[model samples]
Target: MMVANEDVQVAPTRGRPATLSADGIVDVALKLLDAHPKDELSMAKIARELSVSPPALYRYFPTRTSLLNAMSAAVFADFPEMPADRSWREQLLAWQNDVAAVYERHHGVMMLMGWDDQLAGPWLKVQMPVLTLLHSIGFSRLSLVETTSWFLAATVGLIRTYLAADSDGLSRSDLIEFSEGLGGLTDAQRMLVEETREWISRGDPARILNLGFEALVDGVERRLGSLQAKGHI
Candidate 1:
């Protein structure tokens, strides 16, 4: 997961306001991400939002990729520093929650996190902190690395799935209509759907994410116990 600070704006100061800095550009870009979807975000659109010419943005970002990298960095800037005193499970849960919140706020970036070179720095920075916590909790170095990777991949995949499921453009109504025509599901099935939808309406992503993390940790603890019993360490 790409973790960064909330987008910070270039503040107007006593001196002439700084020309569009990387920070300024990222601030506008984040706004644009919220205003528009990932498919719609563009350098030209960001320049327009910032009230600057495209060339002016180029002086700071150089290319669209560079701007994206900056935006990715800014997203991670808000991540809470890893706590030294917390138990490893507590630390991991906190980190996962923080990443999930970041992904929710910048849902557009979920798409980029899987592909962008911009994520590399934050990924590297976070890896050791996470591994150290896992190791401290009795994970072997290899186990720590593998577990961390699995957890991250699973969380990111879940976020992407959640976003895709909630997207308005997909039209769940159409699916219902199609199913109705096919006599696909009985009335009982349709009613179950209504109940499920109602439950979903009240569900919070943060709560759901925490629940998932707990389940994962439970499973890992069981396996770790087995490994220790076998004297694998």
Candidate 2:
């Protein structure tokens, strides 16, 4: 997400001032985060980039947790609203694509996905659209919460596995050697294993994510139909 540089006039100084706003800190922090994992990123690095002391940052964000929370908020600041013109299923897929796009664009976001108690506002902003859609289709209370949780959990797991598999750089020779090591498989098991191996070696993360989403939608539809039949909605 691009942070706009608002035209705020400030007095000239020999060096950067400690009065740097929280937005300014978050902006620099995000740039650093893109190149460095959260565990390796230090406040001193941000301070150096801003031409200020590390202690100065605490004036705005008293702790590292607070600063990380602010960074998370900025990462999702311009989250797209689900389109009003699409069918509900289409809208849900669009939302999943948009959310996945954010994760793909900002590699650092994977680390920032941990929910922070201080970030309820930003979390709700990111989640409420999909949650409301599920609610509209007869999911309620505990089921509503569980369904949303399942979708997000599945999405995150798929992306993580996809990236790891993509980096494997497995070759035909590698797969052949690996396959030869496995013995005692029935013909059917062998076929299934080879197909899965081939798919995982070259599968598109987004396509797999969409397929999982479609499956979830189908399950939800079936549940809603059953509830309607039983007069539960």
What are the lDDT figures for the candidates, one per model?
A: 0.63, 0.68
- Prediction 2 TM-score vs. true: 0.70
TM-scores across all candidates? 0.72, 0.70
Model 1 pairs in collision: 3-76, 4-75, 4-76, 4-77, 4-78, 5-76, 5-77, 5-78
Once fitted onto the true fold, the runs of candidate 1 whose alpha carbons sit more than 4 angstroms away are 1-19, 111-118, 163-183, 194-198, 202-205
Q: Which candidate is the best by TM-score?
A: 1
Q: Count the backbone clashes (under 3 Å) in each candidate.
A: 8, 0
By lDDT, who's the top model here?
2
Q: How well does candidate 1 match the true structure in TM-score terms?
A: 0.72
Global Cα RMSD, each model: 6.9, 7.4
